[model samples]
Structure formats: structure tokens, C-alpha cells
Target chain A: MKVIREKPAVIQRPHNFCAGCSHGVFYRLIQECVEELGYSKRQIIAMGVGCNCNLTLSKIDTVDKFQCAHGRAAASATGIKRMRPDLLVMTYQGDGDCGVIGLGETLNAAYRNEKITVFTVNNLNFGMTGGQMSWTTLEGQKTATSVRGRDCAATGYPIHLPEIIAGQFRPAYAARCAVYDPKTVAQAKKYIRRALEAQINGEGYAIVELLGICPTNWGMSPVQAIEHLQKKALQEYPLGEFAGGEQAELAFLRQEAEK
Target chain B: MQMAKKIMMKGNVAAAEAAIRGGAEFFAGYPITPSTETLETLSFRMPEEGRVFIQAENEIASINMVLGAAACGARAFTTSSGPGMALKQEGFSYAARMELPYVVMNVQRWGVGLGMLDSGQVDYLRDTRAGGNGDYRHIVYAPDSVQELVDDLYEAFDVSQKYRMGVLILSEGYLGQMMEAVELPPFKEIRRPDWGLDGTGEVGLKQLCPTYNMALAHELLPVRQERINRVCREMQRWESVETEDADYVLVAFGLPARVCVDAVRRLREEGCKVGLIRPKLVFPFPYDAFHRVNPNVRGFISVETNDLGQMVQDVALAAKRELPQRNVPVYCYTHSAGVPRVQDVVRYYRSVLDGAVKEVY
Candidate 1:
């Protein structure tokens, strides 16, 4: 077969994530979107501290990249985009950084409708710090902190960021996606691309949550981890556009019916 | 009423206008008492000048916003008071590590912890030192009057950019709230350094904390030290009040310095050879001014607003370093959260003159 698409120049080095890590896949997709959007040189990204730092470590760069103090990426991106309205500003963060440490920053950035794109990877736990329980850890999910599985009564229910943000803040766009299969990966890319588009059109703040699997932390094979995500996690986090869609629920229902 | 071009402007507002004249293009701040006037003034003025200004949700967010703008090479700044200044410490460390330059105006409130909304110099130590985690010291400007505040801030951005480090303006609530006939500087051009983030990645990835590399830091450490030494060598600024031929010298900054001047004049009239050393830049703590003091100077006193007499420590150190042969005593006169009256300061100096007040160092 003839070689067609090549790796993005932005991905200058091999990433340091684990064997079944989804960070690499997500970073590649983001680079693709920036490339496709024709802002390959006119964009900047602020990555919150977490696995997102792997983007900088692996040399996944933009015109400029800021390794913002953990959880301050949203606020930092707010500053960047506001100062240079001509440049496309984006923030990449993990669930822990977004929901746990940087919660105020995330919500306020959305509330202000800052013209920046936000991408949060929800791996169910704080994967980088050896699978500690996170704000997004599913109920009854075991981790470093919650050895007996998560207790919703004690820790509160798993946070649904896109839904909360879409409902409360009325952002330009908000969506959740999974990367278990090729089709889902394509759908996740669509959400990411749409989130970028909303910012491009000056619609205001946009966020997309990508639900990816962690085989090492899940104590399962990569294939089994994907299965776990499909059979169990999917029930909790229904994938669809949550905001900025005319009939998001209806489209979600139709998508479920097709499956 | 505007007197010629000099307006009777509040200190904080004058500083805000001076920042605009000095080429600060971006401002992000959380409203805190004492410093809120600066934020409020900039909120509307920035838009009128077609610059960027944002009221962030909290102190951390505001400083981080400034960090982002500074990274892009915009002249950015933020303002806050005591507790709010504490919240901004993390962002300060991050900016320091990134070697990004920006200005922060702290209209200092009194006391520790939550402190009070009272105008005082309680933030002197924190503002003069690293003020955050790790090892970094930025240039600190301690302005006494509204005109001095305007003048200091007007040059602050350029100084920060020149050194590529944070520059702190230590403003007290007393100074911030009071009005003065001030002349603001004329508008200057905003600068975007060649190293600043432009649309192109031509400079390559502008790395954060290059000092993290031990090997690179081995070479970088000396350069960093030299910059600090150069700052000390070049930026020690102060105002002298009758210290040319005096047996006793008074060391102070900001509001205390203002009162100390009056106290110095009164003491001089009372047949006491007392003078005042008003430091305009606290971090480069005016050792040079000690050169102008009497060679046979009998003693030095630190006049301040904090209950504990914070700046006195620096007074002792500077005296020890600069007046090694004199071996003179260092005294401290302080007020608890309130600006001391000139009468009170003069009374304290009389006690010192009579050997009734003990020296702190």
C-alpha cells in the first residue's frame, strides 16, 4: 500500500505515556485538527500540569506552549486569547487538573465565555500519580485512595463536566467523547474539531471531554480495558454533543439506536 | 479640577494612569480593598485606550492571566493587597521560573494572615524578599507619595522588562487612598521582545524553567547572580533628608518614610542632628545612601508601620555592611497597623536620644 498521511511535525518525539495510554492518540488528533484548520503556525496551547505535560515532554508544540501552574491553564488561556485575539489559544488538561485542582478556573473561564478552546482527558482517575481516585472516578471504582472502590455517599458522584458546563455556563460548545474504537475515535475527533471551530468562529469558550481507557490502572489488557469502557463506562458517560447543538439529546438517542 | 496637566488624583489611580503611560498593555486583577481603585481605574481606561483588562475570579487567576500575557511579550500587570498578595505567590514563582517579566502593585494592608484593610507597611518583608516558593528575588519599588507612586510605576514596566523578572510596587493603603497633585507620564510604545511569543514558532518552543536542568543551571546560576548583583549595583535609589551632617540617621520607606521626614525636621530644630534615609527601592536596600551619612554616625533607627518593625532587619544588615567601622546601635520605632504621627516619631526619637529606648540590633 502507498504511504499517504504522515505524522504531524508538531509531534517531534515519541511520547512517554504508558503502553495503553490514550494521551498520544489525543495529542495526535489535536495536532491534526490544528493542521486541518490552517492555524498550524498561528496557534498556541497552555497545558495544565498532569499527563498533559507529556505533550511538552514529547515536543507536541504550537507557535508557543505554556506549562501553566497546575490547574491554571484555563485562566492562562483566558489571558493569552484576550491579549492576542488574532491567535488561536487552546488549553489541554487532565480531569484531575480540570475538575479537582483547577475547578474554579475551568468554570470561571466558561462563565466569562473566554475565546479559547479547552480539552480535558477523563481517564477515570489521576493516572499519572499512580491511579489515585479523582473527581471523575466512577462509583464503586477502586483506586489508590479508595481501595474499597469509590463511595458516592462519601465522595460524591462522578462529575459530568461537559453536562454541568453546558447547562450552567452556556459555553459556545461542550461535548464528551470516547476513544475505544475507530468509529468512536473519529467521533471524538469530530467533537474536538467542532470545539475548535466554535472558537474559530468567535462563539466564545468551548470544551470537550475525551473519555479514554487506562489498561494499566484498570488491571486489564488493553483490549479488555476498551471493553470495560464500552460495557460499563459508556452507561455512565453517554457520548454526544451536550451544548451548542439544536437537538443534542435527539441526536444522542438516534446514535444509540443506530448502535 | 485639573491644575495645568497635574490633577489631584488618588495614588492608586495615578499609578494606574502612569502604568498606561509606561506601556502596560494588559491588566488582570481581583478586587481587594486598598488596591481596588487601581483595578477599577484600569477596567475602563484600558478599553478607552483599546488595551486588554480583565477582572479575574481570584488573585491566583489574575496573576496567571498576567503570566499568560507576559509570555506573549505583552506589558502585563496585576494589583492586590495583603491576603490577595499571598494568593498570588504561586503565580509569582511560576513567572520567576519562566523568567517572564511583569509588574505587580500591592497596595499593602496591615497585619499578618487576613490582616486589616488599614493602610500600613506590614507587607514590607514579603514584598522585599522572594515572596514565594523557591529562590528568586525581583526588583521591589517602595514609593512614599502619590507622585512618587506614579513615577515609580511609570518606569516599573521598562525596568521589569530590562531585567526579565517580576518588579513589585509596594503601595500602602494610606498612599493608595490619599490624593496628591500628580503629573502622569506621557504615553510610551508597548514592547514585544524578539523572544516573546509571536504567531510563528521561529524562536522554537519557549521552554519553562530552563533552570530545571542542573547542568544548564550550573552555567545559568552565575548569570542569575550577576544580574542580581548588577541590579544592586545600578538600582539602589533613595531620598535623603538632612542626613549630610547628622549623628543619628533614620531608615524608612513608604508612609513611614514620609512621617520620618517630618520627624527629622522637628528633631533637627530641637538641636538633634537626626536625618532620614527614605528608600525608593527596598530590595536594593539603599546601602549607597549610607555613604552619605555622617562617618561618626552614632546610631540608626528603622521607622515603620508594622507592629514588629520588619524593615529594621534590613536596616541592621545594611548598617553592618556599610558602616562596619562605626559599630553603631540600630533602633526600631514601629506602629501597630496605624500610620504613626510625626509627633509620636519625634517622641520616640527623644527617648532614643535620652538612652531610654533600647536598640533592637
Candidate 2:
């Protein structure tokens, strides 16, 4: 079979993410989206300090990248987008980076309707620092910080960033998707593409939260991690476009459902 | 005699106009007391001049906005006072270490932790001596007048770009809120070189900042630090008035320096041989200026607004560097309770002259 889509040449190295890690999946999707949309040259990605930070080490020669202070990616991206509105600006962050440490910056970016794209990956735990309890870790999930399983009473519940952001009217697009299965991966890419489109169209503030998998951190096999995502992560974070559809698109969908 | 137009305005407004005149195209700031006029003026005027101005959600976001804009090679700036400056320290340090050139105007309000809206010297160490974490120093300037504020800020952008580091204009409430006539400089076009990330990324232009990889830092930091040290050494600036044949020299900066100058002139009229050494650039604490003091000078008095006499420590260090064995006496006449009084400074000089006050250091 002739290969219709090859690996993006921009990502030349063997990815440094761990086995069953969803960061690779998201990074590949971002590369493909940028490549297909022909924004590879006019794009700048602000990388947050997290498990996905290794993405900068890959040496993507075409696209510009900035290493942001931990949890300051949205604020930094705000600067980049405001200064160079001609260029497409985006920030890639993890749950702890956005939801916990940088929640204020993320929300304010939405409030200001900054014309930028933000991709937040929720892998249920902080996978880079040997799997600590992240802001998106489930109520009962076990990790390095919560060895005896998380207690919602003390640790609080996992934050659903997509839902929180979608509730805000300023964002041109906001969505939550996953990378557990091929079908879900396609949904993730669609949402990611739409988020980028919002930025391209000059619609302000686009965010997409991707439910990622971390097999090593979760202490499970790669297959088990996928199953765990499907069973638990999806149950909490249903895959759908929470925002960004035009009124006409919604009207058409409603009419089709009536038929 | 230069044909420059003079305008009557508040010092903070003068600073705002000076920033625009200095080719600063981007500004992001949080409105705080004593510094709000700068932001307020820039909000409307910046967009009118086709520049970017943002009333950031907070000081942290404001500095980050500057960091981002500076990364694009645009001349960016921000203004804040005490608490707000504290919030901006993280981004300031990041910019310093990344070698990103930008300007910061700190219209200092009197406070440690929200103390007062009046002018007090609380951030002497915080502004000049490594305000942020880590082992890095940036250029710091304290102007004594509205004209000096305008002139120094015009050069501050150049110094910042030349050094590729953040430069701070430490304006206190006394200067920021005071009304004075300032001659603003003419506009100059700024040039952005073929570097930075101003959307030429396809040709492979990149700006790296805030490193965490210790291995890469270990190899690169020492060289970068050596370059910074050399620049700091070259940029030492101070104003020494009448120390040629004096027995006592008063060390001060900013508002205190203005007061000390008045006190020194009054004491000279009273047949006392006193002088003033006012530091313009506080960080590259002019150690060589102390060497210029006459051998007959008996003591160096630091008249400051901070109660702890933070600048006195630098004065001692600089004095010791010049007179290691001679024991040049360093004394402090601080006024943390309020602004420094010329009478108090004059009184302290007389006490030193009369051998009534002993030099502790």
C-alpha cells in the first residue's frame, strides 16, 4: 500500500517520550496539522516545563519554539501573539503546568480573548518527575505523591480544563479529546485542527485539552493504560467539541437530527 | 543650547513619553500607586503611535508580556512600584539570564509590604543588588530629576540593547509624582537585526531563554557571566561633586542625593569642606569613585531613606576597596520613618566634622 501520510520530517528524532505516553501522539498530531495547514514556517510553539518538554530537543528546524517558565506558557504566548499577530502562536502544556501552577494565566488568556492556541495534555499524573499527583490526577489515582491512592477530601478532584474553558464565552474554540484509540486520536486531531483554525481566522482564545496516557507512571502495561483511559478517563472527559462551532453548523446538525 | 522642546508634566508622564521617544514599542503593566500615570499615559498614546500597550492582568503577566515581546526583538517596557516590582522579579530574572534586552521603570512607593503611598527608599537592594533569584545582575539607574529621568531612560534602551539584558530605571514616588519641566528627546528609529523571532522562523531564527538543563548551562554560563561582568565594569557611572579637597563626602542616590546636594552646598557656605558622591548607576557601584576622594577626607556618610541603610554596605565595600588599611569611616544617617531632611544630613556632617559622631565601620 502506498503511504498517503508519512511521518512529519520536522520531527526528525526518535521521540523521547516513554512507552505508552500520549505526548508523542499529541506532538505528532501538532506536526501534521502545522505541515498540512502550511503554517510550519509562520508558527511559534511555546513549550511549557513538563513531560512534553523534550519536544523542543527534537530540533524542529522549520517552526519556531520558545521554552517558557514553568506554568507561564500562556502568559508568554500572550506576548508572542500580541507582538506578532501575523504569526500563528501556540502553547503546549501539561495538566500541572496549566491547571495547577498556571491556572490564572490560562483563565486570563481566555478572558482577554488573546488570539492564540493552547493545547493542554492531561495524563492523570506528572509523568516527568517520576509520576507525582498532578492537578488532573483522578480522585482515587495512585502516583508518586499519592502512593496510597488520592483522597479527594485532601487532594481535591481532577480539574476538567476543557469544560472550564468552554464555559467561558471569550474563547473562540474549546474542546476535550483523548488519544487512547485510533478513533479518539482522530477526534483529538480534529479538535486540534479546529483550535488552530480559530487562531488562523483571528478568532480569539482557542484551547483543547487532550486526555493522555502514561503507562509507566500508571504502573500498567501499554494495553492496560489504553483500557484504563477508555474506562476511566473517557468517563470523566467525554470526547466532543465543547465550543468553536458556528451557529450555522449547530443549526445544520440539529436539522439533520430531526430527520 | 540644543533646540529641544520642553514640556511641563509629572515625572511619571515624562518617563512614559521618554519610553516612547526611546523606541520602546511594547508596554505591559499593572496600575499601582506612583506608577499608574505612566501606564495611563501609555495606554492611549501607545496605540495612537502604532505601538502595543496592555493593561496586564497582573504584574507577573505584564513582565511575561514584555519577555514575549522582547523575544520578538521589539523594544518592550513595563512600570511598577514596590509590591508589583516584587511580582515581576521572576520574569525580570528570566529576561536577565536569557540576555533579552528590555527596559523597566520602577516608580518606587514607600513600602516593604504595602506600607505607604509616599516616597520611601525600600527597594535599594531589591532594585540594584540581584532583585531576583540566581546569581545575575542587571544595570540599574536612579535619576534625581524629571530631566534626568527623561535623559537616562533615553539612554537606558540603548544600554539594555547593547548589553542584551534588562535595564531598570528606579524612579521613586518623590520623582514619579512630582511635576517638573522635562525636555523630551527626539524620536529615533530602532533597528531590529536579522535575529529574534519576529516571524522569520522559516529562515531558522531562534531566541532561547530561561534554561533549566544544567548540563548545557554548565558549559555556557561561565562564558556568558564573564561577558556580563566585563560590561558591568565598563558601565560604572556616578556623579562626584567637590570631593577634590574635602574632609567628608556624603553618599546618596535618587531623592536622597538631591537632598544631600543641597546640604553639601549649605555646609560649604558655612565654611565646611564637604562633598557629595551621587550614584547614577547603583548596581555597578562605582568602587573607583571612592579612590578619587582626597586623602584628607575623614568619613563617608550614606544618607538614605531606608532604615537599615542598605546602600551603606556598598559604600563601606567601595571605601574599603580604596582605603584598605587607612580605615575610611562609613556612617549612616537613614530616614526610614520619612523622607530625608537636608537639616538632618547637614547636622550629621557637622557631627562628623566635630568628632561628635563616631564612625562605626
Model 2 quality (TM-score): 0.95
Question: Which candidate has the highest lDDT of all?
Answer: 1
Per-residue alpha-carbon lDDT of model 1 for A63-112, expressed as tens digits? Answer: 47887999999999998898889888999999999989999999999999
Worst 10 residues of 2 chain B by lDDT: B203-212
The 0-to-1 C-alpha lDDT of every candidate, in the order given, reads 0.88, 0.84
RMSD of 1: 3.3
Error of 2 at B243 (Å): 0.3
The residue-by-residue lDDT of candidate 2 on A1-259, one tens digit each, is: 9999788767666777788888888888987888788887788887788887888776544567777778888988988888899998999999989888889889988889899999989998887888999878887888899988899899888788877887855688888888777788888888889889899999789998888888988989999999999888878778787777655368779999999
TM-score of chain B of each: 0.96, 0.94
| Candidate 1 residue spans exceeding 4 A from truth | A60-63, A245-259, B1-4, B204-208
The collision pairs in model 2 are none
What are the candidates' C-alpha RMSDs?
Answer: 3.3, 2.5
For candidate 2, give the docking quality class from DockQ: medium
The Cα RMSD in angstroms, rounded to one decimal, for candidate 2 relative to the true structure is 2.5
